[model samples]
Target: MRNYWVRIALGALVIFTVGMVARALINRGIGGVRGVVEGSGPLSIPLAFIPFRLGGDKLGTLERVTFERTAPQSVSSVRLEVKLSDSLLARGLEGCRLAANLDSKDGHRRLSESTFWCAPAGSDTALVEYGQAVFRPGEVSVPLYLPQDLIDELQDLNFDGDSTPISEAEIDSLEASTELSVDSAPVLRARMGDSLRAEGMRRADSAKGVPSRMADSTRSR
Candidate 1:
């Protein structure tokens, strides 16, 4: 019986190892940004083992983000691309979306309080496109995309005839009203979700030597 148990344990180990290696191979083809350096930073998001919708508590936000001016030969454009892992996506997602909070030197304040659907294919990994360029990398909050329904609620907030945008505090208050809480990570908030967006905008605003055609798209805001 002892020998049988040992064999079972060994078999489980082998299966686990093979699964890990297979996941790595599957992701090897996906290329991340080359010039910009990565760091283990405060950027994080709630995660889960099973479908987060099923009460699984887990999170993995930004592993790292930094600014790099020297572009590699392989890098033709300024679009920042980040790859998600296969194993993580396998757990299932309530929804895939992105948010940002950035301040541009040109007096551009970007805040995507609403969630934008980012993952269309539902593949093992998702390619999150900022659709913007970062010219100067700054401290930006990076968080997983908030649930789509939650974002809809934020978007539906009444402006009440005020032409100007709502304050960040109001945004925070709105999020607080939801009373949403996650066991692994703090409930998503506008300020935290907008970190990446703001950083990308700052980079785009400060970026130099970009093509003229691409320039308009990056600076449209």
Candidate 2:
């Protein structure tokens, strides 16, 4: 009886250890998602982890931002390019949104821009283009754009044009320093029907005991 109990305890310990290790691996694999936004100024906004779920039925996170030039020194139209990480694109993109950050009042911000859903990536890459009007002196508001959890990260963005725009040489140097590809591809957007269908399929698969592929698709080296 004593030997049998010892064997059972050992087996339980082994199972517990294996479970913890697998959980750790899953967490590390399902890492944060990111994207880069360029133009509107010399500097750019790099948004990440804007309220995404991990290790669940949810597959990915969506980030939408609008770049606006303030009045007195505004361009007719600013060329904005957003490059998404393969991880975010692989799990699938919900949409792109142009949000304005209006002058905040009543201790809250408001969104005046529109929202757009992007198409799923059928290949390794995709692109889209869009145009937005500039408002001088008045602010464009994008209140609920960023993931609420990661909203604090926006404080680091240098929207003020006081700083010199990145020089061509600097841009070239930075591009050379990184292996990441920066494309002028059209912005990626998915249709609302596609999004709903995808979500329904994911839910059905979940109920059928199928594991989510988000972590497998999003794991970055």
Candidate 3:
């Protein structure tokens, strides 16, 4: 009887562990039901328990978050770290971290750093620092446009980068980086900083600066 009871308890423990693991995976997927709950409004996540693990190869994720109001307009700080995979049980989100310091009252969008990749091999790297951004609320969508010269300041960006009036394609790319909340602007606005750092702006620093068209669009809006 003692042996049988032990076996039953062990089995129950295993089943409970399995259920928790399954629930975490299902809810933590990006855009998966989990993401919607954790990554949405007010930045506060309410659930029974949030188990956080590490991902070192494929994708990393975090959800069901909460924020304490530090100031009137700012949420103080936000941090997200998780790992998912292009393939199941894939290695994990190696060397992955995302940080955002947003000031909605001031319309400032700052993305500290984003590094996603496999351990020992960085697939993608994006970093922003040393400056600030101004944002404007849009009707259909909230669009964040660079100060023109700032985009050009990014190391690799063409001072004349298809200066075609901030095309929709560019906007879409930025959106992928910045979402509706958590900065609420497209990423292109911030990635420009990465471009500047990557291109070693010091080498090709231009007095001519970014295109004038940049100003027209930003001001017009």
Which ten contiguous residues of candidate 1 have the minimum total lDDT? 43-52
Which lDDT tens digits does candidate 2 get at residues 1-221?
23322222222122211122122222323232111112334222222322122111222322322334332123222222333333223222223233222223232232112212222333212222224321111222211232222233232333233334434353233233221211221233455324544654564567456334655556742
Indicate which candidate wins on TM-score: 2
Ranking by lDDT: 2, 1, 3
On residues 30-113, what C-alpha lDDT tens digit does candidate 3 reach at each position?
245444322323333322111222121111233222332333223333222232222212211111232222222222233222
- The list of candidate 3 runs beyond 4 A from truth reads 1-43, 46-62, 81-94, 97-221
If both were scored by lDDT, which would come out higher, candidate 1 or candidate 3?
1
**How would you encode candidate 1's per-residue C-alpha lDDT over 85-204 as one tens digit per residue?**
332232122223333322222221222222123334443132333223111123222223323332332233221223344343543442332223222333434453344345544555
lDDT of each: 0.28, 0.28, 0.27
Off by over 4 Å in 1: 1-60, 67-106, 119-221
TM-score of each: 0.20, 0.21, 0.20
